[model samples]
Target: MADWLSPAEWDALRLSLRVSFWATLVSLPFGLLVAHALARWRFPGHGLLNGLVHLPLVLPPVVTGYLLLLTFGRRGWVGQWLDQWFGIVFAFRWTGAVLAAAIMAFPLMVRAIRLSVEAVDPRLEQAAGTLGASGPWVWATVTLPLILPGVIAGAVLAFAKAMGEFGATITFVSNIPGQTQTLPSAIYSFLQVPGGEAPAARLVVISVVVAMSALVASEWLARRAMRRVQGR
Candidate 1:
């Protein structure tokens, strides 16, 4: 393992983990909200909103990156305001890499959660409401419990996607070592250099292992949650 993974590879692995963890954590609540809305709501522009939420899945990563750059780059409207008002910057930074990854992975997360939410029996939610539970209480005690498995699956899917993200991250955040350089970016950089193929191969192995582990853990969590919901 030591021979396979050099110091740079190790750094890339750690950075990738950090980025994916943050991306998944930060996106979870938003994914849940969107999923709930799509699953239950019937308002004007609902179709439009649903389409927009899933557009990332259909769009090219490079196009998504370019759009993010246009909306959140240093000179762009939102980025400029964030820099000036909050002293926060995303362009070409590790945080920006996280944002890009989150955006790219969001559709997958939303789709999974939405499907789960839709699968939940609305009759149970109505029954909870009739039993004197408020809207928030019904959602908290009834809807959410039924969809726990989906939430876990979605979070893991987003995490894995973020771990392997490349085009959007690189286009939005550039490849700065020890900064925005993730595992995939590191691998790409290694492949571009002479005498770097072996290290790149090692990183690839690490990436695959990490991804597989995440998926297995997600499956386990999903099954556990499903069993609990069934017991309920």
Candidate 2:
């Protein structure tokens, strides 16, 4: 594998893994919070919040990327503030790629987690509360344990989705080599050049393997977590 790929290709592959890992890791906590809110909360604008959370799934990836660029571009509002105050800039950077991947992957992660949260028995949480457990404690000890399988599934799903993210990332970061060129972007770039099919094909195989492995791992982890919860 090392000999088959050029240094540039290897850089893209490594960067893709880094971007996907960060995207999944950074988004997991927010995904869990949003999933829990949608599953259990009945606050105002619930439907609106849910719709907003899922909008990326329905919207065109290009459009989502454009919106991200508009909001996070150097001259943009949030982008300017971050650059001025925090010395942070997302435009055309690897961090921008992470943001795009996370945004594109968010819906899948949230959906899987929401389903898992919904499947948990509410009575278990209520019983824990009756035993004098605080709300947070009950959630931490009982509700979270019951939904651990789903959470694992959701994280794996998000990670896989991030691995394949292209459109938004390209639009946001412009596919710079060794900087923001993820697997999909690298594959696309290779396709645009002469005699690039072989490299593209190699990356395609890697992408398929990574995606399938993630799915399999998700299933295995979920089952393990379920068994743990059942004390079996």
Candidate 3:
């Protein structure tokens, strides 16, 4: 392992974790909102919103990345406004990497959350409302607890997806070593070089380990949450 990976490997590993965490955290609320909308609402644009949310699942990662660049690039519309107003730039920054990962992983998160939400008993919500709980209060106290397992599962899925994300991240953020070169991107770079094969292999192993650990943690959390909800 030492022969394969250098300090740069450690940096990439840490950055991947940071990016994945931020991506998952930032997207969770939105995922839950979308999941609730899909479960309980039937507005006119509902289908469109659902389709848009799942577009990343079917669209090529490169295409998604290009779209992000077009919309969030320095010269791009939203990108220009953000840069001018907030001094926030994502074109080639670590923030951009997080955005790309979040976008790509959003569908998985939404799907998991929506399934969980749909499985919830609306009758229980109605009872809570009848008992003087407001809609938001019922959701906060009742619905959320029931869906906690799914939320955890979705977050884990998103985190895993973010960790392995490469095409969208590279296109949106470009591959800047130590800044934006995540584990997958670093592996790609190593594979392109002659003596970099061993390092690439090491990174791949690390990625697998990280992904496995995340899965195990998520499963454990989901089970624990399920037990708690049941106990309640």
Candidate 4:
């Protein structure tokens, strides 16, 4: 793979994988919580929450990035407080790229998981509760297993989305070479200069391969999840 992609290209690819992995991992717990809430609960502000969750999909990537920058940048309020108290910085850094990718991929993950959650029968959980299982235990042993396929599918989709993320990442962290440059950013960078089409094409191929692999993996996992659900 190193020989296949140039050093810079390899860097971008590596960074993209790293960012996507961390982003997906970090988003999982939150995704599950939000998905369950959206799927099973009906609060007073349910519509508002749903709209807010899907807001990023309708908004331009640049606008989302700008908002992230304004809210999470070094000089931003949250950023300053974090920096002062926790020493965690997110502006123009790799972590910021992860945040951007996570946020960009979140809605898709939530939607997939929400659909799965909706498919589950509430009676199973109620039965578990009647059997003296705590809510969390019931969720862990019952609800979670039933929706494993959707969770896997959602996670893989988020990974693919994170891999392709460009606009928000670039806007939030800028193209700072190995520090913050992702696969899409590298491809964009390649396209900006003369005699860069070949490299850009190569990166595009890489992107397609990675995305396809994620999809294939998702399908396989979904099937496996079904098998488990069936006790096969």
Candidate 5:
């Protein structure tokens, strides 16, 4: 496979993997927090919060990418401030691709974990609390353990989503080779030229393989987590 694929293809594949990994890892904590709050809390504007969290799912990918560009572009408000204060930039860069992928995948991650949290028995957590465990402790020992499988599922889903992310990533990062060009972007690039079908097909295959592998791994991990939680 190494000999079959050009260095550019390898770079795209590696960049895709890196972007997906970072996107999932960076968003996991936020996803967990949002899922827990949505499942357990009754704060004001709960419906609005839920809708906002899921807005990306319903929004057009191009629109999401545009919104991201406006918010995180070098000359944009938030982007300008971050760049000036923290030297952070997300425009036309690999980091921008990560941000785009994470945003695109966020809704799926939250939804999966939220559904899992909702399915858990609240009394189990309440009992832990009544035993003098603090909120954080109860969540750590009981709530999190019960939701481990869900967390795994959510992360895997997000990773897969990130891997296939194209529209938003291209819009936000402009698909620079060896930098921001990810697998989907690479495939799209290859398809634009004459005689590019073969390379594009190769990338499509890699995408499929990666996605399937992630799903299988998620299932295995979830099952193992459940067994451990069940003390079997």
Candidate 6:
């Protein structure tokens, strides 16, 4: 199977995996935090924060990419400051692709975790607190364990989304081969050229396989988490 794919195609596949992994890894913690806040805390601007979290699901990917470019591009305000102070840049780089993928996938991850968090019994947490467990201990031992399944599911969802992300990625990074070109971008590139259908079709198959595997893994993880909670 590896022999059948051209080096360029292989690069795209590997790059996609790399980008998706980083996106999921970086976003998981933040996603859990946001989901926990939304599910457990009632604060000012809660609705606004929730809306912002899910905005990408409703907004066009192109628009999100454009906004990221404006905020994080080399000459953009934040981008300029970042470049001047920290020498970090997001425009047209694989790191930029990771950022785009993370943003696009964030809502799905948050939603999954949020639902799972909401399903957990608050009474269990309260009991733990009454037993002299501190806030952090109750959260770490009781709350976190119950919601592990959701977190795993959310991470998987985010990973799958990052793997398939195209519009925001392309818009922000311009699809530079071996740099910012991910699986979806590679597939788009392949389809744009004459006699490119074969490669495109192969990529499509690869995408499907990856997506299905992630879904299956997510289910398995979720079930395992549930079993652990039940056993405890």
Model 6 clash pairs are none
- Backbone clashes, candidate 4: 0
Model 6, 47-145: lDDT tens per residue?
A: 999999999999999999999999999999999999999999999999999999999999999999999999999999999999999999998999999
Instruction: Give per-residue CA lDDT, model 2, range 1-232, as digits (tens).
Output: 4798989889988999999999999999999999999999999999999999999899999999999999999988999999999999999999999999999999999998999899988898889989999999998999889889989999999999999998889988898999999999999999999999999999999999999999999999999999999899
**Candidate models: Cα lDDT each:** 0.92, 0.93, 0.94, 0.95, 0.93, 0.95
Global fold similarity of model 2 (TM-score)? 0.97
lDDT of 1 at 115: 96
Could you tell me how far off, in angstroms, the CA of residue 110 lies in candidate 2 after the best superposition? 0.7
lDDT of 4 by residue, 1-232 (tens): 3587789998999999999999999999999999999998989999898898898788999999999999999998999999999999999899999999999999999999999999999999999999999999999999999999999999999999999998899999999899999999999999999999999999999999999999999999999998999789
lDDT of 3 by residue, 97-203 (tens): 99999999999999999999999999999999999999889989999999999999999999999999998999889988999999999999999999998889889
Q: Which residue pairs clash in candidate 3?
A: none
TM-score of each predicted structure versus truth: 0.96, 0.97, 0.96, 0.97, 0.96, 0.97
The top-ranked prediction according to lDDT is 6
Q: Identify the runs in model 1 with alpha carbons over 4 angstroms from their true place.
A: 1-4
Q: Against the correct fold, how does model 5 do in TM-score?
A: 0.96
- Each candidate: RMSD to true structure? 1.4, 1.0, 1.6, 1.1, 1.2, 1.2
Which regions of candidate 5 deviate over 4 angstroms?
none
lDDT of 2 at 163: 95
2 or 4, which is superior by lDDT?
4
